[model samples]
Target: MSDVNVIPDMIADPSAFEDDAAFRLKAAQAAIRRECGWHVMPNTALSGVINTRGGSVIRLPARHVTSIESLTDRDGNKLAYAYDPETGLVESLSGGFPAGIAAIRYEIHAGYDDAPDVQSVLISAAKRAGMSPVGLVTSQSTNGSSASFDVVSLMQAEKDKLKPYRLGGLP
Candidate 1:
């Protein structure tokens, strides 16, 4: 709930920084990580059968997955699995996700699990690239209470830091 940044703060404010305050942490983390992902927290983990396409590895739930807390089946039995913490690839230990009715469910904590040294880099990025700016206030509705902010994308410098952990292992 608190971890979800599903909404872009039109009233952008990273000043609202709390360790767990909001998605800014991951927005920053995502920016630092420079990849797409589910970014799951304890409460937000999704449950479902991830089709393995007749293989041992299940496609990562998102652009990235930080950790796999557990894997289970429809019977609610825990299944053994392995994964690359870097690439988010999970493979069945005993066998594949199995070739039958979709039954495997996942409980993963996805996203950049660690903090980068340059959080400010990400915060600055959010203000500049994370949000969109309104071009020319056409009406000026005089809403009494007003707010303003800018959004920015992850800078090339910032992205470079995450390259080692990046998929394809780009150097």
Candidate 2:
């Protein structure tokens, strides 16, 4: 049916939402409100002439944050703007329990999904460290790419061995 002919029936049916100008406007407003509310957190609003008014609040959805936004005593300054769906990493802090003293020399290859034949080497390296070997980390880069790995279990191993040295102290 033509767009013009379908309008009357859409308007006639209350259950079905018609693809119309009014519906589009409502959808746009909803999108705006959703984005706006992402930045606001819920709290008790204290007000009124007698100073005896309080109510429940609605809090904002927390984004995957790694660290504090700012180092300030105030609440607002300490919070970061909600995270957007992008390439940010989510880091978790553990309570000082070391991860079995094992290290990884991760490798990635070009052929996507062809598991590399380095699992035995990883297990051997972990075994050399005197720790119970757990698992192996493997990855595949896009076409025309290549990678390598050589994990060792020396406690004082230099950071530059794994990645380009960021000159400061061992991380």
Give me the candidate number with maximum TM-score: 1
Against the true structure, whose lDDT is highest?
1
Clashes of each: 10, 2
Candidate 2: where are CA atoms >4 Å away?
1-15, 38-171
* Candidate 2 lDDT, 1-171, residue by residue in tens: 345433232133233533343443343333322432221112222111111111121111222222332221122222122322232221222221112211111111111122122222223334443332421112223331432212233222321222211111122
Overall local distance difference test of candidate 2: 0.25
State the local distance difference test value for candidate 1: 0.52
TM values, all candidates: 0.48, 0.16
Q: Which segments of candidate 1 are over 4 A away from where they belong?
A: 1-34, 40-49, 62-68, 84-87, 99-103, 110-113, 127-151, 165-171
Where is model 1 poorest over a 10-residue stretch in terms of lDDT?
135-144
What are the candidates' C-alpha RMSDs? 8.9, 25.3
Cα lDDT tens digits, model 1, 1-171, are 344534444434334433232444455656554452333222244455665455787665553555567688767788888877655567788876765566676776544444453455666665554343442121221233444423235767766654544544521
Clashing pairs in 1: 36-63, 127-150, 128-151, 128-152, 129-151, 129-152, 129-153, 130-151, 130-152, 131-151
Give me candidate 1's TM-score against the actual structure: 0.48
